[model samples]
Each structure stands twice: as structure tokens, then as C-alpha cells.
Target: MLRLLTRFIGLLLLAGGFIALIVDGTRSIAGGRLLVTTLNKGASEFFPALYQGLQNGVSEKSAFLWDPVFTTLLLLPISVAFGGLGALLIVLSHKQETTPRYWRR
Candidate 1:
């Protein structure tokens, strides 16, 4: 049950990432330049208050974490971040077969 749920969520995130990629590609083509939407920009646009709170919370915990780690993560392309995370979750949740079909009796 949990595995199914995880895969479902992962599929949703992957779809979202694909949609974002398409939008970014369209914008870049129209503007005649390479353009990418960073995770920070997308998060802030969608959830301004939550994003601000996350920044504040991280900053309060550790300046180094906020400046280097968090900022670096936030700077990743939104599509990459979401797609990578979704892919990871899907892979992690996958069931492994112990026996090969050819070896089965």
C-alpha cells in the first residue's frame, strides 16, 4: 500500500516537472535565449509565505546551511529538482525480484 502511494506521488511530481520543463522551454524559445526557472523562484511564486518561513527557519538554524547548502539546492532548475526527486522516490520504492524468471522452476 505504501509503495503504491509513493509511486503515485512520484508520478505526480514527475508530471509536474515535465510540465515545468515544457513551460520553460516555450519561454526560452519565445525570448530567443536560454532561460530556466530556479527552484527558489518557483517555490516563492507558488508559496510565498511558506518559502519565506523555510528560509527563516534554515537561517536561524545555521548561517552556513542557509548560505551554502540551502542556497545551492534552491538554485537548481525546478524541473531538475522535482524530476530528480521523483525519480529517486520511484526507484527507491521499486520492488526487487530475488529470483530470475529463467531460473525459476
Candidate 2:
């Protein structure tokens, strides 16, 4: 029963981690492209002060926080770790089957 429980939890976590990874990866890629395109298009439309600030790279630091790729990358390690831990638990939960000496002919 304990083994089953462990296996179940392991499977759940493994699946969840994989799903998160895939979703985050896709979102990150799409978001990065969109951000670049938008920034380029909006560059000329910005007010003089804002345009100068952008040219001076003032928003670079804060922009990183808003980047989906960076956010997703941050979550990647956690997802990978959870998946690895779940796999380990699943392996440990496996039982070694054996037969009694009396049953061996």
C-alpha cells in the first residue's frame, strides 16, 4: 500500500512537471518573439523622454523581470528537480519479488 501510494504520488508529480515544462517552454518562446517585435514597433512611437530612456538602456534591467523566457527558465530547475525526485521515489517504491526456498524445486 505504501509502495502504491509512493508510486502514485511519483507519477502525479512527474506528469505535472513534464506538463509545466512543455507549457512554460512554449510560452517563453512565443513571448520572447512577441516582446522583441512589439519593442521594435513601439520604439518610434514613444515620447522623446521615453525614447531616450530606452536608447540609454534604462529599462533593460526591469524588462528582464517581465520577460516570460526568464520567468519560465527560473521555473525549469524546479520542474526538473521535482520530476527527478518523483522518478527516484517511483524507483524506490518498486518491490523485489522473490520465492520461498521451499517453493524452489
Candidate 3:
């Protein structure tokens, strides 16, 4: 029962993580739409300011690039680990045995 629970949790997290990535990837497209809307409203300065700040940010002190790299690297191993664990669980799941249960002949 504990094994089943653990497997369930692991699979759940694995699937959830994948779903989050897909949803989060849509942010780029959504952001483009937001930018267009903002520019149309004449609130155009904020976006360029944000972009310049990102560009001028200190690489080591700020999260502009390094953060994404670090986050990506961190998530990559976790994703791979979970996937492998799920696969191992599937491969190791019990199968019908060759040995027969004791009973009347």
C-alpha cells in the first residue's frame, strides 16, 4: 500500500510538473498581447524601461538571465529524475508468477 501511495504521488507530481511547464510556456504569447495592449493605451514607457532594466542588470546580482538558467538547470534534473522513477516503478510492478499457489492438486 505504501508503495502504491508513493508511486501515485510520484506520478502525480510528474504529470503536474509537465502541465505547469506547458501552461507557463504560454506566458510568452500572453505577454506579447499584454505589451500590445499597453502600447495602445500609451503606457508604452513601462515596457522599455523594464527591458532596459533587465539588460542593465548585473548578471550575478540580478535574475535576468542567471535565474532562468539556474531554474532551468534545477528543474531539468528533477524532471528527469521523476520520469526515471516512474519508469522504474512501471518496470518493477508485479507480474504473474511462474510458481503456483499451494492448493489441492
Candidate 4:
């Protein structure tokens, strides 16, 4: 029963992570132009020092890192982690499909 519950929760996490990824992806795509603008605005609001440095002539490449593209990319790992952890739990709860070679001998 514990195993069954674990597997159910794992499946839910996996589904939820994937769903979140899809939604985030769509949002990033839809707000393409607003991506950098929003990130800059957010940074100004939350991390003024970082925003100040960015405004002080940071490299274009470096500036882009603070944009929505990077933000979306950053979320990939979080979603993947959720799915990976859920898969791990599901695998841990399941019985081995094959007997160990040492046991057979």
C-alpha cells in the first residue's frame, strides 16, 4: 500500500512538472518581445545592483543571460528534477523484473 501510494504521488509529480514546463514554454514564446523588457523590469525591482551593473554597459551576451530566454532555460532543470525524482521513486517502489545472477547460481 505504501509502494502504491508512492508510485501514485510520483506519477502526479511527473505529470505536473511536464505540464508546468509546457505552460512556461508557451508563455515565454508568446511574450518574446516582452521577454528582456520584463526581465530587466523584474531585476530592477528585485535586484537593483544587478540591474545597475547591467545598465552600466555589461556585454550584450552577459545582458542577455538575464533575459527571459535564460529564465526559461533555468526552469528546465527544475522541471526535469521533479520528473527525475518522481521517476526515481516509481522505480524504487517497483519490484525487480529479473532475479540477480548471483542468486540464480
Candidate 5:
């Protein structure tokens, strides 16, 4: 029973870890790069408009515009971090056997 429970828990953890690793890897590779490109273009195009908008908002004093793009961009870092941590946990939980000498140099 204990063995079964352990295996069940391990399988769940393994699956979660695999997901996190994929998310982080994808963010770090594709998502992060895309964000960098998007931000570069957005900033270049919008700096003047952004400054004027900020000035107007400051005068209004209680309104703000949140960008979903920023949030998504932020997630790329968090996903990568969580994924790395999950991968580490999965790796640490593995019960590795001693490598056979025949398989070693």
C-alpha cells in the first residue's frame, strides 16, 4: 500500500515537473525572445505617446491602464523559474541505482 501510494505521488509529481519544465523551456526559448522583440517595437513606437499618457494619468490621479502583454511577458520569467524548481524536485526524488562498472568507462 505504501509503495503504491509512493508511486502514485511520484507519478503526479513527475507529470507536474514535466509540465513546468516544458513551460519554462518554452518561455525561455520562444516566449521570452518574442517578448523582447515585441517590447522593443512597442517601446520605440509608443515612447512619446506613453509619456503624454502618463502625464495625463498623473493629472487624473486615480486611473491606470494595465497591459496584458506586460503580464504575459512577466509570466515567462515566473514560468521559467517554476519549471526549473520543479525539474530540480523531480530530479532529486529519483531513486537512482548505482551505475554498473560495465556501463562505465
Candidate 6:
């Protein structure tokens, strides 16, 4: 059940990543330069208040964590972040085979 849920969520995120990639590609073509939306920019645009609050909370908890770790993550291209996460989740959700090896048989 949990695996199913994880896979479903991963599929959704993968779709979102694909859409973001398409949008970025179109923007880049139109602008005559490479354009990519960062995770921070996308999150802020989608949920400004939530993003701001989260940023503030992280900064307050530990400036080092926020400045280095989170800043680097948030600076990644939105498509890369979403696609990477989705792929990881999908891979993690995969079931292992239980069949015995031929040598054991």
C-alpha cells in the first residue's frame, strides 16, 4: 500500500517535472537564451507565504544549514529537483524479487 502511494506520488512529480522542463524550454527558445526556473523561484511563485515562512524558519534554526545546504538545493533547477526526487522515490518503491537463485535450487 505504501509502495503504491509512493509510486503514485512519484508519477505526479515526474509529470510536473516534465511540464516544467517544457515550459523552461519554451521560455529559453523565446528569449534567445537559456532560461531555467530554480526551485526557490518556483516555490515562491506557487506559494509565496509558505515559502517565505519556511525560509524564515530554516534561517532561524541554523544559518549554516539554510545558507549552505538548503540554498544549494533551492538553487537547483526546478525540473532537476522534481525529476530527481521522483526518480528516487520510484526506485525506492520498487519491490524486490523473492525467487530463489538457480544455484540454490
TM-scores of the models, in the order given = 0.91, 0.49, 0.33, 0.49, 0.32, 0.92
- Please identify which of the two predictions, 1 or 3, would achieve the higher TM-score against the true structure: 1
In the order shown, what is each candidate's alpha-carbon RMSD?
Answer: 2.0, 13.4, 12.5, 9.6, 13.0, 1.9
Predicted candidate 1 versus true structure: per-residue lDDT over 27-98, tens digit per residue: 999999999999999999999999999999989989899998988999999899889989988998899998
What is the C-alpha lDDT profile of model 4 across 19-87, one tens digit per residue?
A: 756765776799883222233344567899876776565446575755655556434444565678788
Which lDDT tens digits does candidate 6 get at residues 22-55? 9999999999999999998989999999999998
User: Candidate 4 — which residues are off by over 4 angstroms?
Assistant: 33-77, 97-105
Judging by lDDT against the true structure, name the best candidate. 6
- Model 3: per-residue Cα lDDT over 1-105, one tens digit each: 766776676677667546544544565477764221121122224466764554456464776665666345434433344456666665555465787778823
Candidate 1 wrongly placed segments (more than 4 Å):
101-105
Give the higher-TM-score candidate: 2 or 5.
2
The clash number for model 2 is 0
lDDT of 2 at 96: 78
CA lDDT, candidate 1, residue 105: 62
- Per-candidate clash tally: 0, 0, 0, 0, 0, 0
User: Which residue pairs show backbone clashes in model 4?
Assistant: none
The sequence of per-residue lDDT tens digits that candidate 2 reaches over residues 32-95 is 8422212333334556676667545634767655456433433435457568878998999998
Segments in model 2 whose C-alpha atoms lie over 4 Å from true places:
33-76, 97-105
Q: Rank by lDDT, descending? A: 6, 1, 4, 2, 5, 3
lDDT (Cα, tens digit) per residue for candidate 5, span 5-77: 5555656655655565565467668755633223334344558688557546654664433344333543343
CA-RMSD of model 4: 9.6
Candidate 6 runs further than 4 Å off = 100-105
lDDT of each: 0.92, 0.64, 0.51, 0.66, 0.51, 0.93
